[model samples]
Target: MARESFAIGTVRIRPGSARALELPITRLVTGADVTLPVRVVHGRDDGPTVWLDAAIHGDEVVGVDVIRQVMGSLDPKAFRGTLVAVPIVNVLGFMTGDRYLPDRRDLNRSFPGSARGSLAGRIAHLFMTEVVAKCEVGIDLHTGSDKRSNLPQVRADLDDPRTRELAEAFGAPVMLHAGIRDGSLRHAARERGAIVLVYEAGEPLRFDSYAVEAGVIGVRRVLATLGMTDEVSEPPARPSRECRSSGWVRARRTGILHLDARLGQEVADGERLGTLFDSFGKTLNAVYANRDGIVVGRTEAPLVNSGDAVVHIAS
Candidate 1:
């Protein structure tokens, strides 16, 4: 009993089967072609089409492993729908371990890209057309940029009932109602009638075990909620601690920072988060919480400049 095959690019992924292929992006100066690697899993039964993408910003490598573990755990015969996994979106940046492309454009900011545009733009257009346009639901995985680390959290436009439902189903410790950014993948996907969730955790260029575990569990819960899979045995945890508003706490002075607060800790307004010190054991300034909220993100790097984002609090 052979199952049906699904078409993506020039390949046909047979149902109840999985395959790895490279979607052509562009060729390099040395006549080598750069391509985005994709893994497609077409299930035995019909269900909603869903996409899981990671590493739009090349430095955020946590999601790359997260997607890998996800694809490994899934069995096409048991799945109910199609699963499209793009582990690395920015191929050039991933190769160089840089956050942005060589063209100095942020790949995450180039969404629904143009064919006649820049490198990032072309990649964006290719992904939107070939991957996103085929899915009804999308989850864009991410990590905190620079030296910052984020608590396991789901950020989405919760106004839409379906989006909110999926966000809550993700079962992250915290869920933030973040507005759509211009030219973001979330925005582009939503424009095409897909409910997208931006899951953020850990720090760029580093892997956090807890964050990865949470992400794996959260994505599975979403799949169960969408009826795309029946393997989620454990029910999703209680509703995520919701935050409608959030803001960053900036450094008052440029110095070396000794952080006191940690991710997922509750801080009162005006509470001392950390202290900045000069080289001579002198206190340059003490950073305080500007709002009473949970610490959703914080800087892991010691060096800082004046007005640099030090902590992110969400209420």
Candidate 2:
């Protein structure tokens, strides 16, 4: 049987073809239209439909490059099933290099939204109905926020066998069994029976080469595992760590932050990770790990306020 056309908005791609389309969102005050850019690849053969999205937080640009790499290398004639990719989800924020929308709303926290709702809510609703609803699997790409840097990792529900299998196939440095957040895309998609994986790496607003390479490689690995395409399938240098719980180490005293701990370093409980120094170089307070865990994320800012999250440990 001939494959039917894959449609988004008013754009339709036939089997073994690809096309670029735009989803119109609200407009700016200058009367300019803000549209979400999308790419669709309809494979010649039938297989699982998968979606790749990024930059729900506009400051995170690594996923934008990752999506470009993945979509640029695909050959619809050799690929199987449909591939829906939205490289930049928050168009307005992306343009201004901000993390949230103009209304100061986090797009990630507004999902399964309504058509007549707020701007973020309406975009979420459009994405859910037009893109995610047609996909059997999804990979949401992200990076660390608020001057933090994250080691490349995949966060998902590891209890499910299939999701676990795919997470293993992704080949990130760590696989954390993370739970769902209210109004998150992961939560909404899972509720609709789609297997979702969230890939976190690098820092917001900058592209880390290592993190981007790992993400591209891991994404290709997942596609290969799903029989979508025979792309690169080499395993990572080391096996991914399976972490069940993780927490952030916060600053006890506001001061100039100095950290000696490195990403991927395994720290023992009670070990001093770093220290806080006053303006005159006096040690105000010391930071210590409360549990034995691997250092997966840490702040890059030189100064921190009291109770600010400084390091992220996963165990």
Candidate 3:
């Protein structure tokens, strides 16, 4: 079978191969060119086109490792369609070891952006035009923000059947039925009739081996589910659970926090999740769960202020 070709501006890509395309930039740094690196691998046969992107927040590098491992293991000859992998979308943020761009915009929150807007907006617009429009499905990878940690999980609106299926096939440790945020990649992809899954794991600026392995295997499972690759007879084990909703547990008073529970641990209503203590080791207050659920995320830093979110419980 003859392979199809992809043309994005002056860059031309042939099917059943991989290459890194440089996206032109103008706004992030004056006179400095920023490139959005993409790896396109199209199979020789017919199947669904899937886009796997990671590191939208530069510091969340777990997805980057996952994508790299998946890309390396895939055989184009065995694939049925195209797999576009963008390992690092926020080049500026990744370079500076930060989550947000130099302009202080959250790349994840700047989706379906404008070409004439800010740096993040333009990059988002470029991705929407060059990649999202050409793919049938997508998986956007992410992790917890600074000083926070998340268990391996998939966040999607389970109301959408396709999204639900992808989330399940991704095989994360948990699936959170999250609402779609405005200007998010998932929202933009859904608006364009493409089902996109958001996989969250580990923490920013650090790589968890378990999270990376899970993400890599999850991508492979999704590809197999989509008929892009053959299914493995024995896939890796996943430790995920489903949750209907999740919310943050905030600190009631300013003090140092000592967590009594860890991520993935179940908590009961009114159970002590943590304790706040004064500088002199005097107990100030005890933090309890208002509802029974699983601890999916929490702040790692011990310092806390009144109303600071210390933990996230999902039910």
Q: List the residue pairs that clash in candidate 3.
A: 173-240
Model 3 lDDT tens row, 287-312: 99977999889999899999998899
Best by lDDT: 2
**Candidate 1 per-residue C-alpha lDDT over 1-315 given as tens digits, one digit per residue, 9 for 90 to 100:** 555688888999988999999999999899999999999989999988899999999899989988989899998988888999999999999998999999999988899899999999999999998999999999999999998999999999888899999999999999999998989999899899999999999999988998898999999999989998875776656679999999999998999999999999999999999999998879999999999999999999899999999999999
Tens-digit lDDT track of model 2 for 123-228: 9999999989999999999999999999999999999999999999999999999999999999999999999999999999999997899899999999988989
**What are the runs in model 2 whose C-alpha is more than 4 Å off?**
none
Query: Each candidate's TM vs. the true structure?
Result: 0.97, 0.98, 0.95
Q: Give candidate 1's whole-model lDDT.
A: 0.93
How big is the positional error of residue 130 in model 1, measured in Å on the Cα after superposition?
Answer: 0.4
How far in Å is the alpha carbon of 255 misplaced in model 2?
0.5
Task: List clash counts for every candidate, in order.
Answer: 0, 0, 1
Candidate 2, residue 81: lDDT: 90
**Candidates' lDDT values, in order?**
0.93, 0.94, 0.86
Could you give me the TM-score of model 1 versus the true structure? 0.97
At residue 213, what lDDT does model 2 achieve?
Answer: 91
Better of 2 and 3 by TM-score: 2
